[model samples]
Target: MNEPLTRQPEPEYMDLDDEAVVYAEADFADVNAAFVERLIELTPAPGPLLALDLGTGPADIPRRAVAARPGWRIVAQDASFAMLSIARRADRAMGLVQSDAKRLPFAPASFDLVFSNSILHHITNVEPFWAEVKRVAKPGAAVFLRDLARPDSAERAHAIVETYSGREPDLLKEEFYRSLLSAYTPGEIRGQLERAGLAMLDVALVTDRHVDIWGTVP
Candidate 1:
């Protein structure tokens, strides 16, 4: 049996508008593009595939997924209504749904793929979140998770965020650090997936700070 360390209560302030959180500056476009390319490469199956973009901030992943594969149908869900509004306004292809990641409002085996980026660590309860993912995704469906790994110090995380966004995100800095403290190492992530009944396919450290864990539903 696998056990998660540092369990904490979910914070109310974590639900920020995706547009506000994501598009703090123009450079986020490049970041979004890079994530989109990675997601495309990870799942190359021809669509009419059903995709659920968990924490679909500003619906970037869903928008990019639709652009990459026109036959794909995306359910863009977020806990923030403001984010869903931004997503709906930005992309016509997305079906916007406001919901929490830990308790997805979908039927069992409802999706062919589930993708999330930089959102898992924000969640406080790992077990329920993974359980919901397993419930909603079909057997053999692909899951992609990208998040910051544990850092030696909060300063390192803040420095990276500052470098990426070109400004200090003071409000988000402490939260980011806390999230990292609770984040999974490569081994820990694979263990969590296996315990959640997901079959691991690949796990890679994309950068010193970021890790990508891909797996299939068993």
Candidate 2:
């Protein structure tokens, strides 16, 4: 496998096009719902749990989580005000916060469960993400994080985009390709976890283009 691209953060303005993102992500609900199911099955937190959804773009995954696991109050945060605005309109049950993932506003050990999907690739340096996640999660808190795994080569990345996003709009397909190039491999993620002292979390390739890191906060 060829190396992943040098990390490049997505443009800040991309999040402002909430409608475009929502449309692009419409077909991904089932797979994301499965992510929630696997997370719950892996770490069964008790009811009335406090959950944090970091980088909850459009809050699609969190919305699924709330429906599948009732009484689990969720505070979903994203840096984008436009995205949060759309999420708030779509679902009022969960609290919405506009905040950076690297510097959360919550108190230490404030959450029983923490999860994020497809957000890792967006961070140019992932250390702060690991730090903040560890800081806010309560001891033994369930954690589930997932992101697209970078392909071995540009050709492979193109194939992935063609296979998965062939029917999507031109802009969405191009964005997906860029995201694939920007994603990290499993080994890279393991290294990141070790450096962040988060190696205790179980890391695995859960799909062709996805890697999941899940376990309790240790």
The best candidate by lDDT is 2
lDDT of 1 by residue, 1-218 (tens): 33444433335223566435544333456667888888888788776899888887777777776888888888888888766667677776579888888888899999888988877766756788889988998998888878767655556656766665455355555555566665667777777777876645577789877889787777
TM of each candidate vs. truth: 0.82, 0.92
- The segments of candidate 2 whose C-alpha lies over 4 angstroms from its true place after superposition are 1-9, 18-25
What is each predicted model's overall lDDT from 0 to 1? 0.72, 0.82
**Superposition TM-score, candidate 1 onto the true structure:** 0.82
**Residues 30-147, candidate 2, lDDT per residue (tens digit)?**
7787888886796565478889998887788888887888878889998987777777888877699988898999999999999998888888768998999999999989889989
Task: Report the number of backbone clashes for model 2.
Answer: 1
Candidate 2: Cα lDDT at 41:
91
